[model samples]
Target: MLDKLPVVGRFLGGRVADDAGWRRMEALLRKCERRPVYRAWIGDVVVCDATLARRALLDSDNCLAREPSVWQFGDKQRVPAATVTELNRWLHGAAARHDVDAAARIAVVALAAASGDLHRAALLAALDSVADMLGFDCNPELAAAVRVYIGDVFHAKLVNAPLDDAQIARAQGLASRVAALLTTCDADLPAVLRNDGVLTGAARGEVYLHAVLSVVGASAVMLAWLACVLHMDTVAGVDTSADSRAQVFTCKPEHVALELLRLWPPASAHGRRVLKDHQVGPVKALRDDDLVIPVFVLHRHRDTWPDACAFAPQRWHEDPRPAAFMPFSAGPGACIGSQFEIRWLAAVVRQAATLGSLQLVQVGRSPCANTMFSPPRCRLETP
Candidate 1:
C-alpha cells in the first residue's frame, strides 16, 4: 500500500499504525539499518544512517531546506516568514517562560473545570486560553468554532481523506473571522509582529491568522503527546505549593516529557528540498527533489540505541541530553521553541500529576498524518 503512494506517502500513506506506529517503525528500522540509504521511491530517499541524517539536517549552506509537509495535508493558509520570525522572537525572548506558564495555568484551570474527560471540548477549551494570552479576543464559543475548522483540516490530512465542500467552507469562514479579530487587536498588541517587521493589509491578516492558528494547533498537538507519554507511565502526581511551584518540574516530569519526545516526536519525520547535490556519509542526494530523514525509524535504529524499542525514562537520568537527539530536529532549523515547549508541557503534567497518575485508557493513532500525532486517549481518575 505504501509503495502505491507517492514518495512522501511512506510517511503519510499508511493507515494509522496498529500500535502507535512503533511496531511498524521498528520493523522498518531493522530493514533500513542494513543499508545507509534506501530510495523508498524514485527521488525520495529515507536516510537511515544516524550520522548522515544529522549532517543532512545541519547542512548549514541551505543545502537542505525545510519543506512544507503540513501544507500537503490540505492546509491552504501558509505561514509567512515574518509570522515565523515574530513568533520565534517572542517565544525565545526574556518573558517567554513567564508568558507560557501563565497561559498553561489558565489552560489547566479550564481543563479541570470542564466535565467529562480530556476530550476535544477540554483540549480546545485549554487552547483558547493560550490564544487569549496571545491577545486574541477569543471566548469559549469562538474557540470551539476555531477548533472545529482546525480539527477538520488536521483530521482530514491524517486520514488521507478529502474534506467536503461544506467542511472547507466552514473552516474558511471561521479562519476569516479569527483573522478579522486579529486585525483589530491593539495595534501594538503584537509589537514583535509590528515593529520588528512590516506586514500590512492582507499580508498582516494572513500572518496573524496563521500565527494564532499555529499557536493553538501546535499547543494541542504537544499536549496530545504529553497525554500519550502519561498514558504509558505511572508518574506520581503532587500538588504545587508555595515552595514546590518553582522546583516541582525539576524532578520526574522533566524525565517523563523528554522520554515522550524520544518516542513520539511531534514530527515523526522531516523533509528537506535539496539545494545542491552532496554526499552525506555515503548517500549522494541530488537537487530539486525531497530528502526525508525518518526520525521515527532513525530514533529506533538498532545499532544506535540499545533497547531502542523499549520506553525508558531512566535513560535521561544517565544522560540529560543524548548526542543524536533530534526530536526537535538538529542544526539551524531545529525547533526554536524547544525549551519553551518542554518546560510548558512538563509544567502541565506536573500540575495534573497532583490529581492522579496518568492511566492510559487507550492511545489512538490518528489517521496517518504527516507527523506522529497519535493523541493519547485517557481518562483522568485517581489510581
Candidate 2:
C-alpha cells in the first residue's frame, strides 16, 4: 500500500492521486493489461484479466482480505461482515419505500436552485431524500460532516494517500457524530442494527456510519455524473427533451443510467490485500501484495465490449450487462446498494428528460480522477 505514496509512484511507476498522475497510472494499466497479473508498482500487483480479476475479487475461499482504510472507522483492519449485512438491510428497506420519480423531481429542483456547486446540492438533496425515505429528520450539520469526510478524509484513503492528524481526528469524531444522529433520527435503526447482538459497541457505530455514507455518497456522485452526461449530450446537439430521450434510449432509463456508470465509475479501482500466496492464470502473487482491479480500464476492455469507449445505451438493449462490467465491484464486497442507486439514477434520467435542454455552466472536461472518477466542479442550467 505504501506504493500509493506519491513519492513512491513518482520513482517506481506512476501515480494515482491527482489528474496528471491518474493519466499516467491509467496508461500504465492499459499497457500492462496484456499480462494477466503483474506488479503495478512496489507495493501492489495489478489484475487486468476479467476472469482472474473476478476470482480474485469474488471468491471467498481465495484468502484475499479487503484493504483497511478510514471506512473501517477506528478498527483499521477489515470491513465487518455484520456492518455490510446491516447496510444492505437499511438501504434495501429505503429502496422498498422510496418513490423514485418524486425523489428525482425534488433532486432536480434542488440542482436547479443550487447557488454554487451542483454536486454538493445534489448530495445534500440525496442525503435529505434518503432521510425522508427512512422516516428520519435530515440534519444540515450531519450533511456537512459527511461531505467533509467524503471529500477530504475518506477520499485520501481511496486515492491511497495518508491522512493528516487533523483529518484522522475528524474521521473518528465524524463516526461518533453519525452514530448519535442515527440513533436520534431513525427509530427503526435500533431494530435494524441490533442484528441479534451481533452489532454492539464500536461495531454498531461503524455500521451506522457506513449506512449513511453509502446511501448519500454513492447516490450524489452518480447523480452528479448523470447531470454532467446530460449536459454534455445537450451541448453536443443531441436533443434531451422527453420525446427524444425516449427515442435515443429505447431500452429504458435503467440502461441509460448503466451506460453513464460504465463510462465514469466513481471508484477508479478496487483493492484487496493478498492474504496468502495465489496464482490466477500465469501470474503468481505472494501474501501481503496489494491486488488492484482497475475498474475504469476493465470497463473499456475492447475484446469484451464492442466499440467499448462510446456511450451507447442501445447496446444494453441487446444485453443489459456483460460479465466484465463491474461498476459497483463484484461478489460479496460489492456495494449492496447498487440496484437501489441504479433505480434512483434512472428516475433522475426520466425527470431530466422533461426539462428539455440542459447545459453545464462550467467548461466540459473528462471525468476528474482525483478523489474519485468525478465530474469537474460545475452547475446545471436548464433552458
State how far residue 173 of model 2 sits from its true place (Å).
Answer: 3.4
Q: Candidate 2, residues 1-383: lDDT per residue as tens digits?
A: 11231232232211333445455545755675577567755757777788788877886786687532423645564455665555566668877787888888887666655555555666666766665664444566655665565555654543335666887777877766655555555355546454435455445555565666666666777777666555544412123444534543465788888877776676667777788997766767789887878777778777777777666677887885766688777875676577878888888877765433545686423334544555555666544
> TM-score for each prediction?
0.74, 0.78
Per-residue CA lDDT of model 1 for 1-383, tens digit only, reads: 01111224334333433233444454565678787776664677678777778878888667876533321112344446665555656645632635666666666665545443444533564455566545544345445545665455544544344556887676656655655555445633565334324544344434444444444554556565554443443211112233333333445777766766665566667677788987766667788766777776666666767776555555677774655567667776676556766777666766654323444354244323343333434445434
What residue runs in model 2 are displaced by over 4 Å at the alpha carbon?
1-17, 66-71, 75-84, 134-171, 191-206, 233-251, 354-359, 363-366, 379-383
Any runs in candidate 1 off by more than 4 Å, and if so which? 1-24, 66-84, 94-102, 109-122, 137-145, 155-161, 187-206, 228-251, 354-372, 376-383
- Taken over the whole model, the C-alpha lDDT of each candidate is 0.54, 0.62
Candidate 1 TM-score over all chains jointly? 0.74
